[model samples]
Target: MGGTDCGAYRAGLGVYAIGRLAGAEAAELFAHLRGCPPCRAELAELRRVAELLAHCVPAREGAGRGPRTGASRTGLSGACAYGSRGPGRSR
Candidate 1:
């Protein structure tokens, strides 16, 4: 891959990164990255972005409950209870 091609691939401009890399294709991608400074830089930036996202945590605290009970427990007793009433019908 040349510079433009590498740029296209590195920018997430294609499907390569979206899928698993394997065997000779994986080797070729790595080889291209190894010899290409711009691709290397882009990969570093992507790694940084991934690291930042990996460390991100929710702004909220706990769920503020002991442990969910009742309908929440079985997940079968909510509005979609197994054999309960239909749409507008009450419990």
Candidate 2:
């Protein structure tokens, strides 16, 4: 497939990875993915990113308690940015 053709599918990869792509567009992208190694690689990366993002938002401390301390204050700057730390390791 031509680069231009791939460009359109590439643009929608994020939406597709998140299960938001559907109907004819999704079908077309899926078909293209079967034949395009580059696009397939990109889609894999996007899916990984989407999975990581699912954990970015810290779980609520309770209904009215609000967000966790570091998450709200640092805003992905400290612990949140590094993700899970190992045992005895500091952020």
The model with the greatest lDDT is 2
The alpha-carbon deviation from the true structure for residue 45 of candidate 1, after best TM-score superposition, in angstroms, is 0.3
Error of 2 at 43 (Å): 0.3
Tell me the lDDT of candidate 1: 0.58
Query: What lDDT is reached at residue 85 by model 2?
Result: 91
* lDDT to native, each model: 0.58, 0.81
Error of 1 at 32 (Å): 0.2
Question: How big is the positional error of residue 35 in model 1, measured in Å on the Cα after superposition?
Answer: 1.1
The residue-by-residue lDDT of candidate 1 on 1-91, one tens digit each, is 3534774346441223434556767677777876788776766766676557547954455644534556566665555653467656676
Residue-wise C-alpha lDDT for candidate 2, range 1-91, written one tens digit per residue: 5453788789889999999999999999999999898999999999999999778866655754655555576566445555579435665
Displacement of the residue 91 alpha carbon in candidate 1, Å = 49
lDDT of 1 at 82: 37
Name model 1 segments beyond 4 Å from true: 1-4, 11-20, 57-91
